[model samples]
Target: MMNIMRNSKHPVRTAAKEASHERIVSAAARAIRRSGYDGTGVADIMKEAGLTHGAFYAHFASREAMLAEAAERACTESAAIAAEAAASVPREQALTYMLHAYLSRENLEQVERGCPLAALGSETARQTPEVRRANTRYIKEMVDLVARQSPDWGQAGAHERALVTVATMVGTLLLARVVDEPALSDSLREAALKHLPIA
Candidate 1:
């Protein structure tokens, strides 16, 4: 009788715990992006999630564990944005739509909630293996999504073209953020949009 009672209550406890865990991860995701991965503090994440810092151990094993999960979540979000844009446009026009959206001033202005690769790529080299692996998986997924929308999907250079596009977009966005002058930043974005070898 006691065993049956305990088993019945297990699910409710598990669901509540999972919900709390998600909240922590989500908070970590935004925090890391807004304040670089190395800058994100544990106390800030828990406070953002409306939980005590002491509660962090319940959701994540350690700081690195939270970072890996947060990085994964951020990168997944960036890929999803590109994927959705690709799906909405005609096959031949998909790449154009993606380029427009990715290079837009709006995306550049929204650093906290924008592309993780643009925000964290340079820093990830110094991160743990788990964080690096999560970043690699998401980057591959992004490249694959771009390749699917390529005009030369089955051609000799389709995959390479897609890789170049990803690198250019990320590099351009990074440059856009670093320059002090608005004109220079706009120029970088415009030049890429104008000259990128889009097929």
Candidate 2:
């Protein structure tokens, strides 16, 4: 009877722990995007999650583990946003709608809540293998998402076109963020939008 009673409490404890773990990951995801991987610290993430620093170990094996999960979360969020943008319009206009959303003024200013590829791509090369793997999955997923939007999806060159499209979008956004001049930034985005091979 005692053992049964004790075991019953395990589920409640596990649920609480899972909730805390989610909070940590969510906070870490935002922090990484807002501050970049090298700029984010475990202590800051824990504080952002409203937990004590010492409690971090209870949720993750190491800082790298937390970072890896955070990277995955950020990627998942960006992908969802892209999917939502694509879905908001008619099927024929999905790609254009998604492209506009990706390069919009709102996305340009909302780095913390925008695409991880544009915000973290430069820094990802220096990150740990685990973090890199998380980002790689996102890149693949984003490419697939773009390819599916192609009118010639499943054709020979569709995947290649998606590669170019994703690259162009990411590159355009990255450059737009780099320049301090607002006019130049707008021009860069405008050029990409005007020239992107939309079908």
Candidate with maximal TM-score: 2
Model 2, C-alpha of 148: deviation from truth (Å): 1.1
lDDT of 2 by residue, 101-192 (tens): 89999999999888888998689998899888888888898888889988899886888989888999999999999899999999999999
lDDT of 1 by residue, 78-192 (tens): 8888889999988889899999999999999888778888877589899999889988998898778888887678675888888888899999998998899999999999999
Report the Cα lDDT for candidate 1: 0.87
- Candidate 1, residue 141: Cα displacement in angstroms equals 1.4
Off by over 4 Å in 1: 1-5
Query: In model 2, what lDDT does residue 30 have?
Result: 88
Worst 10 residues of 1 by lDDT: 147-156
TM-scores across all candidates?
0.94, 0.95
C-alpha RMSD values across all candidates: 1.5, 1.3
* Residue 97 miss distance in model 1 (angstroms): 0.5
